[model samples]
Target chain A: MRRALTLVVSGMVAALLGILALGGLSAAATATDKEAANEAKSVSEAAKRAGKKDPYAPVVYGDR
Target chain B: MVEQTTGVGAPPVRRVRDALPLYAVAAAVTVLVLAPLAAPGYALLYDMVFVPRQPLSWDLVAPAQTLPRAVPMDALMSLVTQLVPGWAVQRVALGGAVLLAAVGAGRLVPTERLAVRLLAAVAYAWTPYLAERLLIGQWGLLLAYAALPWLVRAALDLRAGRDGALARVVLAAAPAAITPTGGLIALGTVVLLVWDRTRLRRSALVVGGVALLNAPWVTAALVTGAGGSSDPAGVAAFAARSENWAGPLVALAGTGGVWSAQATPSSRAAPLVPLATLLLLILAGVGAGLLRRRLPPGTAVRLAVLAGIACLLAALGVLPGGAAALRWAVVHLPGAGLLRDGQKFLAPYALLLVVCAALGAERLVARIDREVAGVVLVGLLLLPVAVMPDLAFGGAGRLRPVSYPADWQVVAERVAGEPGEILALPLSAYQAYPWNPGRVVLDPLPRYLPGTVLTDDTLRVGDVAVAGENPRLREVRRVLAEGLPVSATGVRWVVVQHQLPSEVDPATLRDLEAVHEGPFLTLYRNPAVPPESNPPGLGAWAVVMALGAALLVVMAAAISALHRRPTAW
Candidate 1:
């Protein structure tokens, strides 16, 4: 029983952490997050105006 | 073959309970002794280095799918700071480290006498190496240091074929999730566990338990290509050098000698103070030798040999052959980069020295009355504190924390409504904020701003030779040096300091509009950009691995419980 319980508890904690990460559950970014996001968006928009493609898309590094 | 005489004969849980009062006193004294770290609203030296801007969420965990350093320790610290103020969290965390060290020392030392155990606990908690590390602001490494004694105790229990050894080892191995040093110590404990061939199966279970506890960080490092460094210059700079053999020796006696920031050179007495301090420790060590007969012969010899070997390895850089050997291994082997800070090896040596010193002092005062013996024991306990007054109430030579500038808060509010990543110029990680004169601190920008803003000012890894590899980091640097690039790097806002770089042409920024202008900061926004929608490709893989890791931990825990012995000895 003790061994079984230990397994259950460990499994639950690990699964919970995994779920948290996998769910992409944004626990609501503060005012600061909104500002930082907006700022980056603004820069991407400027890039678009300068004829850049998909300026608002995620910046993927090819080397990574 | 041998009857247990280390007082570890009793079940560990019972032994720990019996010593609860002593542990409490040790913890209380630790907090009192290091009161300066917990001063109201004043942050410790490196609190800002680890403080994340936003609270710890699922996003902090690294696994190639998330940001780097998804280690539990970082996440734990970030989570705590979100609820508690940063300065208070730093103080409590530091205080908790000393308390943990005290408890581990109390539990590990085999002495039966309460006074002797308590004295050893104090010695282990208040050593020169502890002070030097604290002053150097390596709290993550210090967490591992605090956990070393618990590892030793758990290892010994496993060797004795005691019940619940696997459980204890798992509990003690918690530090590994935060710092690799803890993982290294956990490895040593595994070697000790497996040393008893008859108990090989049980020991393997303990190893599995440790691996499970460390899965989050270990998995992250393996998956993310995060660990390893081959920088020769960093190796030279951080490696334990034998150039001054006496430096580490004196440090073991509670005098400072690692980095310039941690080094303490007395002016009035000059060399005499350090020499005298060394002599005093040597005298205590000699006393310990006289009482060596009291220790179980096997345990005493093993600890002594271990201490000697650690001391040798810590000072290996003194010789040309040793230096070459370390350099070779660092370049050829993976994970050997951690040995660059070779002084960390002294953690175990210091533990052994304090235990032995306590035993020696116990014998020396054996004949005295209880009151006088108590006084002598307390004096012995305070010896390290007396030798290093700077780490005591003096706040470790740091002053009170200064509040952030009002302009920063105002700018943060103005930028909150914007979306996408933001960049701050001039991009630097560690800065000497004019508001807090005379102290260097991690840049407060990340803490004040929200969401994934990018800055390369802080070295992600400490003093490692790996050059900055991220093209994004390079593009950001270029954008800072030259004006905003012809192509966008997905940065929506550019926050330029009051004094812009000479090469940066404001006119070159297309569709740029000034949102907020201040004496200290100017915020520019590109109105043409929209909010980011696409997620990274690895996000799904990360979630899957995370769930797999959870299952692995469950299996390991079950194995540990299967090996558990009945409570009755």
Candidate 2:
């Protein structure tokens, strides 16, 4: 009975680890994707502002 | 079969072999977390600015107009960068913080099981508190977080009257005392843990030693012309923020809620993350009994009290009637502004939680089958990393290194040749330069250049504008708002940073003589005010004396600790 219980517990923990691993990976990929999107936006903005004499001023400090 | 021992009289080879796993685990964690720092240049994130060589200027040592938030930290950096380059210093500081944090927590656990120790090591080092602080680039506070477990151990030893323990306490706390918030945490830890009615004299000495270590920042705060009071708006601006539906309180309970959303790990927003926090708390509760039984009488209770105070302070801004009370205190009480960003005080709570949870894991496995216990311990070890894997590879590449533009060096040289007060234009306290993409960093001009550089101090947290107490910055803001020329208000040099989102009106630079103009930064000298060199005053010297005294205490403790036959540490 004890051996069976140990096996059951081990299985539960293994399942938990798999779920957590997937969750963590998805979150990390989301952050990377966000960064890439921001970079693309910056590039487009720079192209639009090209040849302009006056500097473009955004918000001094970013949102929290 | 062979037997091993780690007692005082154990063989040196055996001890090293026994400790090999802990060291390996710690190294693995450090390498995994800081893999991005292996790149060539400096990582200049917000408040984490490192220059090639920070000139030893009086303003860096002691501030005359502003609050001494970075008091001895900047001064120490300036002194160290004189010999060692800034890039090396940055690597050492970050690497040492992560590695020492893991080892310290692993060593602090009372369990005999190696798996339990490793659990504590990984759990403590990979905490959300450490992650948020590191992502926000508050490396000084991270040093405090890293030093805490070691400090607690030394304090416990001092309470037990162990030889050289007092010196060990001072040595452990020295790194934490680099910043004011860290200093207070160290002082609070020593007082709570080491205070004893039986050994009153020794307790007083230990507490006094840690107090003196905090003297540099305290002395600077006393002498600063910015005065002690801060804007009450900051109480709301810097409060602990809720990452998910768990709310701010649950976030604090899990040791995850920092003020800035940008600083928090994205995984924290997962709805299930709160469930993990609940599990950890339940485990901590299960292990509380073990902790009380294992520790010396009253010691566990004292640690609990310290942890309680930390949690209370961290949640004060979000609590009922707590924000109002904190607001009133910050406005009326001197040095109370330090309490505004109370999440930084969570270091002690994070340490205590990890230690207790590790013990809880031990208790859980004690009654199980041996093979099952091994599997469970392995699962526990992987839990922290599993929950927040993005902490690996430098917070998912948020901490990538970038080289400073050549314009910075040219501006520094010009300012060094003729030193005077510099007004940084486009008038922003923090900047998002084109060179350092996707990172909002504090204007590096103040530390990179020689003389006193005045940048805007107002902090914009979302849409809420938190006011700063620098009188000079306020005057400069007024001058600029009225559309006055840069030369009219500035004492000497004016730097106009280009390619930033903020624009500097061409009319503002009409009267100033352009000294050096580059693609990134433009240096303009105000011909109206002649260049003048200002020497350090008596207040600055007093701060220096306090730093020197703190150094002497550490040195004396070091000598005393080394002289002892068997080191208690």
Candidate 2 segments whose C-alpha is farther than 4 A from its true place: A15-19, A22-64, B1-5, B565-569
Per-structure clash totals for the candidates? 23, 1
Report the C-alpha displacement of residue B262, candidate 1, in angstroms: 5.2
Q: What's the TM-score of every candidate structure?
A: 0.71, 0.94
Tens digits of per-residue lDDT, candidate 1, B98-171, equal 88888777666556677777877777776767765665456766777787787777667667666766566666
Per-model C-alpha lDDT, please? 0.55, 0.86
Residue B259 in model 2: lDDT? 91
